[model samples]
Target chain A: MSEKNHRVSRRQFLTYTLTGVGGFMAAGMLAPMVRMALDPALEAAGDSEFVSVGLSEDEVSEEPQRVDFSIELDDGWYSSEQSRSAWVLREGNEILALSPICTHLGCTVNWGTNEENPEEFFCPCHFGRFERDGTNIPGTPPTRPLDVYEVEVRDGMIYLGQINQRG
Target chain B: MRWNENDAKTYQSAKEYVDTAIIPLLPVAGGKEQEEAVRMGEFTSYLTDFLERQYTGRVYLLPPFTYLKEESTEDRLERLKTWTEHFKNQGFSHFLYVTSDSRWRQADARDLGELVWIPAFSLAEMDTNKRQQSIEQQAQQIIPLMTEKWS
Candidate 1:
């Protein structure tokens, strides 16, 4: 049964060793590129995770309040938590969550910052102003209205997702 | 806009829209103290970066102007005025000079720009929450000041 079966041939030994080492080297070279390609897909899976801004349904009122929250962002190999803020208000039966970022630039807009326009949102950067309904005032720097968030109310808690561009 | 190729291109194309220029003045010294100063400067730069991002289209954030702490104030002011003049010629109407060094406060720079001197906050000693809180507080104070200038 025997000596020939128990001992490996030179050709077989060389083929097995070379293939094993070659496969390992190939994987080592391709692993990072594969990860780079798949990273966006992996990150997209977590994109739907809604962050709570710690505001309850009862707390929301007609007056806009600044609500701050943090979100986990994955940029290729780097992962970091970024802080975000939104001006949230309750209008009758609906909730309105508007991004404070000005449409003209990226500056944060304040509610009633301008004493003359107490009902509007005002941008400090360039005097950009928006109406009480988050509409950009005509003749202002901002051409578009403030971005609104997708809101979900669960168990009296408010959850915010991706920002949706509004008119 | 930052002093990078992409932002520079934007600045060039939209010079009319981009009217504000932010210059961060960082002071460096010799020896171990230089390391601490540099670290503080880095934190200051970070704050400027945040400010620039907040008002991206209208504000152009230039890279830090690093100078020796021992350098003459008259000479520095002369050079800074020239720099601001260059920026003004390029269509920038508003100039903001942000620094942690109190020395800049003593310098005559009315022709150069508005000097915003913030007390240096110790980033190394604070936790993330405290650091964020400090940054937010500083930002809150700065926003109104910048807005007043615009008005």
Candidate 2:
């Protein structure tokens, strides 16, 4: 309405707009850091999903047998890892799924035939011997059993879920 | 409400209904990697289960025909013939073959008293949004024929 009143109102509007623009610019600069902080929380919400092992029940051996399988796991967009393990034995109708990871130290275990010892799974890292049931023997360096997967069979196929580490 | 809004009460009711009324109607088969396959195959099987459970008067649940990898056509034929003979002996009203493999040709469609060849839909063909629609369509087509033949 009045010239002085109009001038004062225009100055107030400009001040508010500049402050809002500055605030937006600051947020834009810090957005990456904010995302990085919240990344773990987002991952936890969707982490460790169940994956198909692609084995037919008929294919699994009745005795303590080694079945090697690999599954692709995604950590994020940047990387993918191939997780390979040997599932041991189908006890009756249920499966005893074991991870061939050395418990003494984290090392990949191999199934090899020792002429003296017959065929057994051996961890070369510390010379750990795991039985068909994945139990570490008394004299071996490994003090714990191999990891076990929660398994379920439905529609003539197997699915493996989270792994439980032995104490 | 929002487009993706989930009503807890409605969701719970639907889940309870599926668990109690629909799941028992399904023939649960077990195999290696079956749990995973079932998880993937649930969408298709749900339609079959729903129809068998809810429309028992008109629809019959058929036993699944197991597919084996064979080397010779003779072996395949023998297997198929044995399946048909088994069904007939089991007193099944009609027999149907569902397979995703297009290479399987029904040489003897009329061997059994009533046999229908239904192609199994691939996982890629039915996207997530269209899964239920595809199942419903398949059920409508397959169920009608079985009813017409056996009922």
Candidate 3:
């Protein structure tokens, strides 16, 4: 090829450099806005949202303890903080996090609340019972086992995540 | 269950389980400040919402029964009884009343419903966290009273 054809002119060089620099600067300003626009979609796609309930792995015992926690929720247009509670306990090497909502009728179940069912989770509404391991008693109103939350322990802090419904 | 079309559908299919109806009593006219009346309504709503969350399967949260506070106690009682009777006819076995009106305590409203009277306070003056904490504490106190009724 000819020398003039192979070489880049100053005008062409300045245009190429200016376009490259301007593209990067524009992207820098737009990156956050683009992310903000897609924030809800990104959040919906995230499946690993674990929330801490102020209960440590060391604190969890054989007996289930109710711990209250708050999680940020995004509902379409508005985002807000919501309060949630869970019954947590540690057994052998595995930590169990139980959802308090009863499967039969959705009334909250309290552990050791009933005199007759002292060792089990009792539902006062219809006298339903869940075993220590979150199994719904066979003859009880709950057709399925009590839902369990995904448990994660990080640096001794216990984090509870999405419920795994035992259907 | 809340008194909305979506909840009403759930309520129709599960009428046997959803037996309790939560009715709020509000005094719209007491010859008091307008802000005071608003506070009473606000507190009562918070209590009702808390109760519904804890007992959603069994409780139906109805709209408020607003009345003139200047009315005679007998007249209020009689009107409330009419409201209760309608709910009874509709198949509600339990009627829980959440109100900030002190007059309900003195009135012979036993047949009308189980009354939970919470005195009105200025929640607007408090910070967001403090107001939420205060409402929760107040609502928690009413839980045992309801459990007693359930038992």
Candidate 4:
């Protein structure tokens, strides 16, 4: 009676072993493929994200300076170099990298270019204004603050990454 | 904004902001100066593209006005007048006719549109890096002009 209770059918034993081995083998084959598929999405956000804007941490000042840089753009089948610019400002240890793109009309805003509104980001088109900290002043064309870039300081050089939106 | 499917929808929703129109005046000569004409076209179009990139929501880049080098600016201005009139009727408040053709400096083409004539040079002689740098520098200067117009 004890033997009968412990006994396993040969078919059941074979099926269990095969399923366990096959499942592990399938997972082993798919693990690298899944990682490879996710590799680019991670790369764009990881160490490969930061690009030097030809400025160093020491070069950053209180005033927002426009820094132009180029990045390799991939649109599936084709790749090209896309020129991009950002407004870099440093206040104490917290550095800020503002996207030049205006929130309202997508015009490039210059730092302190407007005669009436000096010491602010002024959009040439539609007279939009953003404060030094990227806050959109009320009664202005832009409804939201300017986007900011992720920053990294490597060897005292300023490197910038993807743009991030703020509330 | 542009004459593309995606931008067309954007323009429809934001018609008021897109008040300016840019037309690249391309020179296409068929003979000895053909290469120069192509270079001018390349350079002017690059500037127009840069301008569009800078002010995508406020500006609309129209298809280029490709003309033969043999045609006089006076004759071309007559055709461009029609273009300006048509776009103006469509509610464009400002028009910028940009080109690397120096002939525009001597051409009496006022009242048609604001002519932005940048002097063209041999870009082929430049390395890729220098060429891009020079073009971007020229484009940088043009951006202020467009902004000034808006102001």
Candidate 5:
């Protein structure tokens, strides 16, 4: 009876070892594909990278200056770098970065283009006008203020993030 | 305003504000070298695109006026005059005729607003940076001319 029990224990050990090794091998083969399937989803969620527009705190002035930067965008199967522009101004101790695109018809607006209103942002298209603080002129075509960007200052360098519509 | 449906829709409601129209004059020469003529057409379209982007809402970009290269200047001017007349009826006061064809320069078209003559550039062979620089420079030169019309 003792000899029969020893033989049964040996068979059980062999079976358990085979099952453990086989499971590890199968997982090893499936690991890469599982990671590949999840890669884009992870990237989509991890796209909050900030782009430095190459402006230091001192370079920022009260006058609105054009700053161009490029950002990496991943749209499912395709990925590309897109260039964008913004108008930045320093008001007192605050740094204000506004989108150059007009709120009315998506035209680019220039700072101080109108001689009569040197302090305002002027859009050549449709005569859209915005106040110095990016508020749309009451009687003008633009119904909303210009969009602002998320900003970060690190070691005297200014970085800009996603554009946020003004409330 | 552009020829696109979206811009056209915007134009319908804001007709009074859009007083300017740009008519790109492109010459099509039929021959064995059709490719070169096509390149010129593309270049002309590119320049017009830059102008449209630079002055988005104020100017309407009309479909290009393409004609035979060998067509008489007088005939072309007559067709252009009719087009200008139609645009005027639609409330467009400023008609800008943008062309690389120098023949239009000799035509007396003061009544058709400004005639902007841009020197032809070989855009087909240019790299992206060079092409952008050339377009930017041309746009810069044209801005003063457009602003003068506005004032």
Candidate 6:
């Protein structure tokens, strides 16, 4: 009876060890595949996606119109809207949405034909200036290009997303 | 040379001469210091005013100005974004005038809802000489554009 009990105990230990090893090997084999399967879902977890600004597709003009509006962004538990303004300059068919905030010092820039200098967005704050294409000129304080906003036109209104400073 | 008729008739004579002569001659001095200072001051005031209207509490109009002394341009920009995120989280509008220059300066102003960059150019009038006078003149030219003033 004692001999039989010892045999049972040995069999139980072998079974547990084999199962543990098998479980670890299975986990190792499955980890990469699981990550691959879940990667896109994890990346898309945040629903703070791009919003569409209501603008007619025909409204986009060759001339840059100052698009001033507000959008609501999720503020943790609550939601809040923030005002943002950008110049949507249409080049042929493509739209280049530029932030009016000067890349030089983040001052609001104005676009008017300077009798002294032709059409350009001029920063009156320190004489820093930018071309109509939102490119910063050398010798100016602003080193980076004006930030561009991801925009999409839905129905007849225009929607904008996060402002990104291009690398 | 004697002061010209332009000197007697214009407020910019002292500034112009300084810009042409004194400023150019100065060694290792950053050009346009005065102009930079005036612009910075105007920006600080504008941003502060915008923030005050947007937020009703914990607005640091003149925060520890020495906040960004050693911070890098990227760090400064990140700090600004962080501040905006914080304000957004608090259900406040995040509106602030960030610096135009790639480098964030030694001084910045922040309230709970806004962060205004007090530019490096604010030091333009520190020296009581020609450059300082030029900055004052430039301030006159730039001040009117900033219609809203923070009292």
Given candidate 2, what's the lDDT at residue B144? 56
Best of the candidates, lDDT: 4
Off by over 4 Å in 4: A1-48, B72-74, B125-129, B140-145
Across all candidates, what is each one's fraction of true contacts kept? 0.71, 0.00, 0.54, 0.67, 0.50, 0.00
Model 5 ranges off by over 4 Å: A1-50, A69-83, A153-157, B30-39, B124-130
Model 6 chain A lowest lDDT segment of ten: A45-54
List lDDT for all candidates, in order. Answer: 0.84, 0.54, 0.84, 0.86, 0.84, 0.52
TM agreement with the true structure for every prediction: 0.81, 0.40, 0.80, 0.81, 0.74, 0.43
- The TM-score, computed over Cα atoms with residue i paired to residue i, of candidate 3 is 0.80
lDDT of 6 at A110: 67
Q: Which model is ahead, 3 or 4, in terms of lDDT?
A: 4
Model 5 lDDT per residue over B54-130, tens place: 67768899999888878899999899999999989989988888888777889888877888887676887886546
DockQ for all candidate structures vs. native = 0.53, 0.01, 0.59, 0.59, 0.42, 0.03
lDDT of 3 at A15: 100
Backbone collisions counted per model = 0, 11, 0, 0, 0, 18
Question: Higher TM-score: candidate 1 or 5?
Answer: 1
Docking verdict class for candidate 3: medium
lDDT of 1 by residue, A12-77 (tens): 999999999999999999999999999999878576778888889899999888898888877899
Residue lDDT tens for model 6, B1-151: 1134533343232222111110000011135564554455444443443433221121222231223234554565556556556535544332334333324433343442222233334433453334334444443443332322221
**What is the C-alpha lDDT profile of model 3 across B77-101, one tens digit per residue?**
8888988999899998888899998
Candidate 5: lDDT of A79? Answer: 92
Please report how far candidate 6 places residue B48 from its true position, in Å.
3.5
Write down the RMSD of all candidates, one decimal each: 4.2, 21.0, 5.3, 5.3, 5.9, 19.1
